[model samples]
Structure formats: structure tokens, C-alpha cells
Target: MKSYLGLIPISAKVHRRQNRMTILCIVFAVFLVTAVFSMAELGVRIEADRLLEKHGSQELENLAGSTMAQTLYPIAAVLTLLILIAGVLMISGSINSTVAQRTKFFGMMRCIGMSRQQIIRFVRLEALNWCKTAVPAGVALGIMAAWLLCAVLRFLVGGQFSEIPVFGISITGIVIGSVTGIAAVLLAARAPAKRAARVSPVEAVSGNEKGTGALRHGAKLCLFRVETALGIHHAVSAKKNLILMTGSFALSIMMFLSFSVLVDFVGYLMPQYSDASDIDISGSGGADTVDSGLLDTLSGMEGVKRVYGRRTSFQVPVEISGAAEGFGAAESSGAADLISYDDFGLDCLKKDDMLKKGSDISKVYGDSGYVLATSDADSLLRIGDKVKIGAEELEIAGLLKYDPFSSDGLTHGEVTLIMSGETFIRLTGITGYSLISVQTTGNVTEEDVEAIRAAAGEDCVFSDRRDQNTSGTYRAFAACVYGFLFVITLVTVLNIVNGISMSVSARTKQYGTMRAVGMDGRQITKMIAAEAFTYALSGCAAGCAAGLFISKWLFDVLIAAHFAYAVWELPVNSLLVILLAVILAAVLAVWAPAGRIRKLSVTETIGEL
Candidate 1:
């Protein structure tokens, strides 16, 4: 039972710059988790409410409960996990730097009979104290950020955000932020703690940084382990850095893992949506009530192939519980499905890759909410769920995920389904198609989409798959996420490389001593490299597992927020690619820094230390 006071010395040991970096990372992590989760959830909730509360709406309670009743836990999980990892690394980095400076102090402690356990306990306390000071503050600051966001959203949409918490004062938010922050801090502290406790009293008192001859030791040895004649020797190590080094490596791995998973997951799912065609067409209404017949007429008059329907709408209205009052209160909030008519149904046409998203609603709905959807609407809509229209609710059966790469509009993701004439009339009291898709009757070699547009007239809109731009939206978002992750990874790699470098620096005299006693620079380099390798390998494995779990959760948040959104179509190579890449990078990042170990002057280095 160590006194909390014990944390002071450890705290004193941490560098201010490193501390601030950790704090910033925590802040960003908190912001990312809270913002993404809350926005997606709150937005979908509002979309549902808007539909039902409007005149002629039905199925208010059942639809709302069923649709909005998914989990926010996954969102929380991803954010917490990521933030936790980052925090740990930052703490670990600080600890490693500190221990390098305080190496001798620890040696002195050991000489005085302070046990390794005691030193380890001291470092832990120091880490705990820092977490106590930093994490809570970050959580609080994250919470306060609501006002600013609310003001901004309100200004943009007039009244689409609530002034209050959408999920009850965000208590869960604060708790999560704090917990993750603390967890990260602790995780990063391991390496520094371990190394700081193992210093020898002799090394501590001598102050003469000299080369020592290494005798090998057995089975489980220290950081630098080798299977040699003297068994495996304990070439004196640092206690303070034990925690720091571990933490930094772990965090870096986490970053690598997170980014790789996200990319792989997204990459896996995007192609499933490919329509394989160069053009698709849609309109306001037509025969069979599925294709409006307009696209069929035009394409029949020209070149095209098989066309079909796609799920083009998944919209709902929700009274956002925790969002600000006006956060989702649209001046006129309602729902509609984007569809393509024909045996070539909207859903089928999507299979053909012929949609120019929102083109169906162009003339009638224009860019206005009355017909076209606003990017604002996308924040509130889902892709496969049902949206209420007047007295009827159109099931969003098939539609591309709402994203700007296609076009900015509510209709982008939410499609007003073109159902069986019987189903449509029975459900919506409407017996006409909202849109249609036309297939090229022949080779239909029109690569220029606009040329087909002339044939489509105002009756239909068309696009082809060659350069149809299906990957744009998905790639954009993925790029942003990966780019952000990349920056974090870069920082993490630098920290890791530096930590390893410092590790070698501190052990200069030890290396010199070893060389004097018969150990060569190559052997010493290998030893140091082994230490860095451990960190990299451990970091990567842990990071991959963590990143996958987090990415899955984030995907779920998208699903929960959007009633009918399909599960992301993950690719086969996703997991394999990510794992391999991260592990490779970790190895590479450490390689250069560790390689320099052999470059040190054996005699001079040993003598100077």
C-alpha cells in the first residue's frame, strides 16, 4: 500500500512537453469519439421524428423504438480504445525520457536497498498521478465543447440541433473519456517502470559510464536476451524506462492497427456496391409504378443493357432526445425515396452503376428539401430503413450510402422504394413509380454520361460505371480517417524511434563495457535491436486486435443511426493486408534507429560513460 505521495517523484520525473502531447492526444480522442457517436445517433433520431410528427404520418412509436433502439456502446468502445492507446503511449514516452535522465538516481536507490518492487511502485504512482491530473480535465473540456457545436449546427440549419444533451447530459460521455484517458496513461507507463527498477547499486554509485563484460544468463532474462554460452546475462538495464518504452511501443502499435483496420474494413465493403454499368436513369413517376417507363422508353430507343431497381431510400424522423431543441427541427422535415423505374428497377440499376445521385428529383424537387435532399438531411437519414411520406412510409430498399461523392442531398442515401404496385398502393396510397433505370440495348458505347443524359431528357438521369465515381465518397471518408491516423502514426513512430535511440544512448557505457569484456558492436547492436523489436512486435499485435474491434464498433454506429443501412461489405484481403502492413512498419520504424548501435566507438564510448 503505497501512499499517494509516492506519485510525486514519478510525476516530477515526467517531462512537461511529453505531458502536453499526451493531453492533446486525449483531447482529440475524446472529441472524435464523442462527436462521431453523438452526431450520427442524434441525427438519425431526429430524421425519424420529423417524418412521423408531420401531418399524415403513421407507425410513430413502433418504428421509432425499433429503429433508434440500437447501440451507442460500439461508438463509445472505439473512441475509448483509441484514446486509451494514445494516452498510454504518451505517458510511456514521458517515462522513458525521464528514466533516461534519472537512471543514476534509481541506481542509488538500489544501492541503498530499495527493492525493484518499490521502484516499480514509485513509477506507477507517478503515472497514476499524472493521469489523475490530466484525464479528468480532458473529459470536462470535451463536455463543454457542446455549446460551440450546437451554435454552429443551429446557424447552418436554422434549427437542426438541440441545446441540451441528446443522451442525457452526456454523463456516459464524460465517464468514458475519463476512463479511456486514464487507461491510456497507465498502459504507456509499463516500460519505464520496469527498466527503472533493475539498476545495479554498483552502476548507480560508480558514475563512471564504462563498458562491462557481459556474462550470459538462462531462460527468462531481461530486455536484451540471447541464447549464448554464459547462459543469458543481465547486461544492466534501466527501471524507469521499462514502463515508458512499453507504453510508447504499445501506443504506436495501436495507431497502426486502428488505421489499417479502418481502411481494410471500408475497402472491403465499398466494391459490393458496384453497379457494373456506365449509366442509370430515374424520374418522378411512371407505369408499373416502378420504372416510370421513361428510362425504358429512351434506352429502348437507343443503346443499353439490363437495368433494374435498387434500394434508394432509407429515411426516418426522430425527436432527438439529447440534442439541442432545434438541432433537427426542420422548417419542413419530411421523407422521400430515390428510385429508378424499369424491370430495370432503381435497385437493379444501382447494380448497373447508373445513378448520378439525386438526379431523379432535380426538376421537381430541385435542390430544395421539398424535392432534393440537403447534406444536412444525410446527417439524419439511413440507407435501407423506411421513411414516412405524407400518410405513407416508403421503405428505403436500395440506395447508395448518402455521400457527396455522388451528390449532396437527402435522397442520396434514402430511396423512396418502387415496390410492387400492390404494395405501393396498399402502403402509400400512391400507384406510380418515383423513378427508373435504362440499360443500353447494345454495346451502347456512350462513355460520355451527358450524351445519354440528352436521351434521358427531364424524364430520366443517367451515369455509367467506367468513371461513374462510385468509389469517390467511400474513398474520401476513408482517406480522411486514414490521413488523420497517419499523422498520429508518424508522431508515434518518431516517439518510438527516439525512445529506442535514447535507450541506446543511456546504455552507451554498458555497450562499451560489454565490448571491452569481449562483446562486439554487432552483438551489442543485436541486443538493443532485440529490445526495440519486442516493443514493435508487441505493439503491432495488440494494435491490430484493438483496431479491428474499434472499426467494427464505428461501423455499427453508422448502422444504428441509419435504420436500414447494410452491414459494410468488408474485403477478403482487409485483415491480412492491415496486419501485415502494421507489423512491417513497426519493424521498419525501429530498424534504422537500432542499426546505429554498432556505430558507437567501443573504447571511447565505454571510457567516456
Candidate 2:
């Protein structure tokens, strides 16, 4: 048993390519996990420090022990678990493919009286040996990555992020990465090691690891030539490999799309300055304070693109029949405040594409009766249903996902009913503008903004999206989220690389045989490409569908219900980028290996066979 240990080193050296790939997989996974954990931990620390500075150090002795730090711990835990799962699958698939290729070697060991236990031990030790070298290297890389990330964040956030660590390295992150990396390698190696131990001497010697696949009655033609068709068939014939490869590709796409949705979702739910306008002016007293004269002046101001105004009123009564189950709206009976928009105001809303349902306002100008503001409570109001307001019965023209005036006040628990200016006069019998929003042309300077502010007067309140109170904080959060997402996506790309590499390397002899039978280099490359195309197309399609479905549910649960904002739309740009990335990855995965095979002489390849 002691003597058999020598075989482990010998086997590793003999199959250095496979061993190198396995080590790379472990290294990349550990590196990413460590980097992400470190980043999250640093963020927690920085935030806690800020709190401590605000509340005093005696309030919380250690930043790590703070409430914010504790909250971050769970998020870190969940993210670590997800990364570990992906790492294990990636490492396991690489091992499985490599082991299958080395059946003959395993068989020889079995014939020489090496017990199955010895073989398993040998394989396990080899994996552990690789981890010994890879884990530390990965941890070091992770620390560097985390430091760089922190620096980038500091740069983007400027002096506002005074407490951000310049050289932060989390001890917990290193320990976690080492433990998870070692554990993942062991778990991933078990199946492949067992399979190797079970290989029979005869089967190994004869090089007959698998039986012939189910035969086709007739030759099936494909869009490509015979070589390409044969390659596609060969690729899909191995059900396990096909599924693994496709799944790897699909998960990469799915994660990218879903994370993109999450970013957009969070942005939408959070209170931010409107994208449609550079400056917003509101009446100091009430809805009637900002009049037509002020709006006209703002519209004609230098650098101003356009100006729009809305007449807003609070506590207008609208008849409600069946109140929603849990909205706590029974007290008000769904009698929301009324916000009336003029034609220009409606045009602004249309430009922003803020409507959640119903046709564009222009299409339903004269035909539509009223568009209701989105309600926090699940009110029993449907589009086209005639509901009685103060004095008139009007049809619910549409449902709005956004109303700027309502959102700012509604957080304190108020429901608003949005309508056109004509409807507001008919129902409330009052007509005066409350808020006047300003949109600037091209790039508006600080001087321009000041001029506009002066023109609006000191009494009027001006709000700029660029200078919003939470803009800096939001930028930091967005930067962290996007950086974390990029790391996860990179890990997935590594998985694809490993899966493709193993598949191609395992078929070395088969390729050689084809070469010997008169298949040229170009033909061989095309064959490999066809197989990649099949996998890429199938995987990308399935992943996109799954991602969209998940995004819908996520939007409903996390954003729509929580914020009472029902505008959930697909992140089309993100999905398109993902699709393009998958295609490019597939091409590179095939092209690289094919290029290597093309380098080897036909005789050399046949000799391995």
C-alpha cells in the first residue's frame, strides 16, 4: 500500500495536461470566492466604521459585531455556497472526462493486483496534492483582486467613501476559500476515482470503455457536410457529456441575465431622481403655488429642452367596493389622492415609458377616461371599469407604474389616483399646477442649473438628479453589485473552458483516426465547430428562457410588491450581450483545441491510438 503511493506522482507527471487543467479549475474558483468574500467583508467593515464614527466606537466595540456586519455575513454565506456548488460541478466534470480517457491505465493497475481501495486513494491523494499548490496561489490572487476592487470603488465614490480600506484582506475570506476549495476538490474527485477503480482489465486493454451507441436505420443528412453531421451525432451520443456541457453553458447565460435583472430591479425600486429631467421645481406651499407663469419662464430658459407641470391634490375620495386583503386600506376605502397631468406632463410620462399597462396616452387621448396611479393596496379596480369619483363616473383608462409626486409622499402611507387635467377639474373642481419639471438640452452645466434655479426664485424648491442626497451611496452600491456579478460570470466562463478542453482532449485518438482516414485540418476544425454550435445554440436558448421566467418572478416578489411599482420589463440589452458572449465562447473553445490538434502530425496522433 505504501509503495503504491509512488504511482500517484507518476500518474500526475504522465498526464500533466489533465493535472494542470484540474489545478487551474481549483485555483480560479478559490480565487473568485476569496475575492468576493473579501470585498463583501470590506464593504461591511467600511459601512460599520461610518456608523461608528457617527454613533461613537463605544456604541459598537467591533465593526464586525455590528448589525450591518451581521446582515452581510448571511449574504456572504449564500454567495459562497453558490460559488462552491458551481466550482464543484466544474471540477467534477473535468475529472470525469479525464478519468474516462485514462481507463487503460487504471485497468493495468488492477491487473497488477492494485486493489480498488489503493486506486481510489491514489486518485484522492493526487487531487489533494494539486490543491496544496493551487489553494495558496488562489488565495494570494484573491487578495490582490480584492485590493484592486477596493481601490476602484474608492476612486468611483471619491472622498465620500473615506473609510474604505486601501489594503483590506479578510482573514475569514482566506480560511473560507481554503476550506471550500479543498472540500470541493475531494467531493468532485470521488465519482471519477470510483469509476477508475471499477475499470476491468480486459475492457481497459481492449480500449472498449463504452458500447456502440444505438444505431440509426438510415444515414441522416444535416445542413452541414457529412463530417459536420457526424460530429454533431458523436457529440450528442454521450448523454451524460451532452447534458453536462449544455448545462454548463446554460448556467453561465442564466446567471448573467438574472443578475442584470437584479441590478435594474434594485435601481427601479429605489428612490432616485428622474431620468427624463435634469432639474425639478416644486411649489413651496401646495399644489396651487406653482402656476402657468413660472412654467412658461422655465420653458424659455437657456439650455432648457422642455418643461412640464402637474397639478397634484391630496385625500380626494374615490368609491371603493372590495378592498384588497392586506393593504390596510380599509380605513381609506381606496380613496387615493389625485394627481392630474396636462398634455405636456403626459408627454413627459410617455417619453419616460413609465406606464405599466394600457396603450400610449396619445392613442387613447379622447377615447380614454382616466389612468389610475399604482396602488400599494390590492384594490379591486380594473381597466375600463367605471368608478365614481367626487361627482362623475369615469372609466379607469390605464394603470401607471410611476407618479413622482405620489412616490415621495406615499412612503408615509398614502394612496394616489393619477388622472388627466380635464378629469381632475371635473372631479375635484380645482385646477392649478403643483410641480414643474425641467429637462435640459445636451449637457447642462452648473452655471446653467444655477441660472435656472435663480429664475425659479429662492422660494421654490429645486431638486437635481445629479446632486441627489443618495447619489454617491447608490453609485457605490451599483459598483459593488456590478463588480460581484462580473466575478461570478468569469467563474462560469472558466467552467465552459474546462468542459470544452476536457471533451476535446479526451477525443485525441478519435481525431487522429479521422486524420489518418483523409480528413483535412479544415474539415476537422469544421467538425469541431459544428459540435460547438449545437451545444451553444441549445444551451443559450434554454438559459435565456429560464432567465426571463426567473426575472418575472423576482420582479413580482422583490420589486413590484415591495415598492408598489408594477413596471417589470425584460433586460433586453443584457440578454443580447449574453447570447453574443456564449457564441464567441463556443467558437473559441472549439477553435483553440482544434488548432492544437492540427499542429500534431497524423502519425503522432495515430500512435497514441
Candidate 3:
């Protein structure tokens, strides 16, 4: 009679508490998955256009005629394949955790003479019941969510909706949601099912089942059990179980963080670079023209940072320091990328105040008693040394270089010469100067520089270095890296949500016990939320540290090996966003599971326990 009484609660409890949470989780998962796929498709279309431009191909014109599906299908196919793999693992972990948490209940049913198969059958039926109820409701809600969100949230770039590759409820959506729901349940059941078959009836009746199989060992991972009574008990008793959940949550956090960094890279340039070399001047439409004079007028403009200038027109014949000719090709570039002449800006040396000898050092002093030698140049020639450039010989007083490659991993560059405009003219005998670099005080407006340039005449062009670094290459690369990362995070979060949902399912009896002990349903819910919140924040903390370290190392390596860049500075706001995203995703993942605790029943839970 008691056993029959227990059945009534089990049947009613799931619909009341568990069903709502499952529906919420599944619906959110579908929405994210769809978004990832659609966004990827949009990027592919953009990439296709870029490739056409790069290869000088007419494919874009032809591509324009193709329907949106042509572009979307490739992206969807690839993303769906990748997301499914991760989704499967996450669902499995979640389902397994649920099964593990509920092992004692199964064992007690067996103590009543139920066969292993009967236990499995009951559990499977229970999972099916949860699914049958949740999947339909989730799909319905997901359709509504997509409808509402799409209506309000515009795409990054505007496009025709019916024309754009967007997803709505369809046969495919139903299939995906159904499959995903079932898979999570099936995967979650494995461990619990295994335990039910092998665990002894006496152990099952006890409900602890310690020192059996996987659960018997490996419990030390939980730190400071004293902080939370429940956590301490769980650490000691369910070490293996906690490990699984920890791994799942940690992975989710990492993906969330790394992808966050990638998005920032695309949205903004590094500040020092953005702030310094604030404007590039294309010259010769008129000589110094109004453009050159326009620069002086820029200081008063709003958003004007300090502005500086660059001119690379003076070329002096330079002899190699080591060998007779010294000037030769670098092996990496087939020696093709070498610059034969340079016209450095006077302000370049002045801005840094790097001059060690002669004249306000605003400009290079050629053949002076003291020569400013670059580290690379110094290595080639020593102090009091002379490097023959053309017919003039310059004395090496000190070593100086604007080492952009210091952090880029590349060592100092080979070419070495610092000269004042007067000295350069004396040596090169070239009366003309070209190119202007406007280094602003970080807040200078580009428009202000252009206005200043009008005075310098048509000969000068004012722009940002980023604009000159060539357009769209950085954009594409960033998109690809971050797009892949977004997909990974989406999978990670899904797994987390699934795992948390299973956790709630596994602890239904425990929740009921809390209610039995006079704990409010809301209080029990809060505790579960606390646990989920703890797991997420911990993972985010760790992931953020790891991500920052990794990206910084990568930044250093790229500058040294490739770009010859000088310093690497972190984008603080960007990193903050990344960490914030990790926490946000964690909170979101916990919501579905937390809600389930509010439906606990004292009588039903005590029976299960």
C-alpha cells in the first residue's frame, strides 16, 4: 500500500516541478543553437564577397543571384555538425548526474523485489514522461521566443528578414528539439541504470551506497566544505559526481571567455595603436598644401588628442656595418621585403625624446660628433664607429630605435639611420620630402586632421594607420576565430544547462526532505540556485585568468615574430566584458534547474529518500 502511495507523488511531482524547468532549458538551447547557425551563415556570405574581391573573380555578381539558402546551408551544415557533437556530451553528463543522484530510490524499489529490468523500465518511463511533456512545451515556447526576439533585435547589419537566412519553427526545428531532449535523458540515465543493477538491496535501502564503483573514490576536489554545509557533505559523499559537474562547468566558462576576447578584437583596435599614429597623411596633391597646415588647426577640435607628423622622403646611401656591402636580403622574405630607402618623420624621434646628442634633437644630426645608433645598428657597428651611407660617414654616439617588434617577437630590424632633415638633404641630395604622420594625443578626431589637411593642399592625405593596414583582412580573420568560439560556448552552456537540470531531477527527494524539515519551497530553490551560482562563478574566475594569460602570451609572440611591434597592452574594457559574459552565461544556465526546487513536496521526497 505504501509503494502504491509513493507512485502518486512521483507522477504528480514531475509535472508540477520538473516539467517547467526542462521546458525552459530546452527552449533556450534551441534559440541559441539557431542563432549560432544563422550568424555563421551571415559571415559566410560576407566572406564569399570578400574572396571574390581578393581573387579578382566575378563570383560575387553571380553569388548575388543565388538565394539565401545557398549561403546559409553551408554554414548551418558545418555548425550543426559541430554543435551536435558537443551537445551529445553535455546531455550525457547531465543525464548521468541525474541518474547518480537518484540511485538510492532505484535501489529501494529493488528492495521491494523489482527486477533490474523493471527498475530500468521505470526510470526510462520516467525520462520519457519528462520528455513527452517538456519537448512539446519547449518547442512551442521557443517558437514564441524567436518570434519576439527577432522582432525586437535587429541584426548587426540590417537586411531583409524574409530574404535573410533566419530560422523559424519548422519540421526541422521540431526534430532537433525532440532529438536533443531525448539524447540528454538517455545519456544521463547510463550511470544510474548501471548502479541499480549492481548495487545490493541493503545498500540501496541505506541510500548512501558509499564505497561502490566510481563513487567510492576521488572526492577531495571540493575545497573548504565548511563554507556551505551541503557542499561539504556532497564533497565527501559524491566526489566523483562533483568532478563530472566541475569539468562540464569549467569548459563552458573557458569557451565563453576566449570567445569574448575574439569579439572585442573585431569591434575595436588596441588603444595605443588607436591613440598613437592617430592620422596618416597621403601627400603630393599640392606640396605642403593646406592639408599640412590643417593639422595645426586640429588641436582645438573636440576629441583632438596631441597630433604629430611623419615624413619619409630623405634617403641616404647606407653601407652594411658588418660586411663591405652589409645591405642584403633577409632570408625569411626571400630578401624581397627589404626597404632600400626611408623617410622617417622628425617628430618620431622628438616624441620619444630619444636624442642623446646635438640640436633639440628634434631632427637627426648627420656626421655629428655623436651618432644615435639603433640597437640593431649598434650591434653591426660599435661606439665611435662609422656606417658609410653614400659618400657621408656618420659617427655612432648612442643606440636608438623605435622597436615596434620588441613584443611582436621579431628582433630589431636591419636598416639603421637617424638623420635631421637638413643632414638628410646634405647626404641624399634629394630636395623633396613626402608622407605625413599625425600622432594625436589619443583623442584627436580624424575629421579634424582632414580639415587641417585642407590648408596643406591636395598633396596630403590624413587617415588612421588601421585604415592603411588594408581593410577587411583583420575583419575576416577575427570573425572566423570568434565565430568558432561562439559555437563552442553555445555548446558549453547547453551542456551546463543540461547538467544543472539533471542535478535538480536527481535531488528531487532531497528537495522534498528540506520541505519536510520546515524549509520553505522557496528556500530550497535558493539553495539549489546558490550551488549553481557557485559552480558558474568559480569556473568563470578560473577561465578568465587562463584566458588573459593565454591571449597576452599570444600577443607577445605575434609582435616579436611577425609584426616587429614594440609593446602589447591589454584591452581592459574588452577583458571585462569577457569575464562578465562568463558569469552571465552561468547565471542563465542555472535558471531552469533552480526553478525546479520550488515545486518540492515533503511527503513525496521523504518516501523517495
Question: TM-score for each prediction?
Answer: 0.49, 0.74, 0.51
Please list the residue runs of candidate 1 whose C-alpha ends up more than 4 Å from where it truly belongs after superposition. 1-70, 78-82, 89-97, 107-175, 186-203, 206-484, 487-499, 502-506, 514-534, 538-588, 591-604
Compute the lDDT of residue 465 as modeled in candidate 2. Answer: 56
Error of 1 at 150 (Å): 8.0
Model 3 segments beyond 4 Å from truth? 1-29, 49-185, 193-240, 257-261, 264-281, 285-292, 297-308, 314-433, 436-609
Residue range 574-609, candidate 3, lDDT tens digits: 556545655666567556655666655556767766
What digit string (tens of lDDT, one per residue) describes model 2 on residues 150-230? 676577555556447779779988999899899889988888788778887787765546543567652356566887886
| Model 1: per-residue Cα lDDT over 460-546, one tens digit each | 444454444335445544654565465555566555555565555555565666666777656665665566665555555565566
Span of 10 residues, lowest total lDDT, candidate 2? 323-332
For candidate 3, report its TM-score: 0.51
Question: Could you tell me how far off, in angstroms, the CA of residue 538 lies in candidate 3 after the best superposition?
Answer: 10
Candidates 2 and 3 compared: the better one by TM-score is 2
In angstroms, how far off is 24's CA in candidate 3? 5.0
Local accuracy by lDDT, each model? 0.50, 0.70, 0.49
What residue pairs are clashing in model 2? 370-397
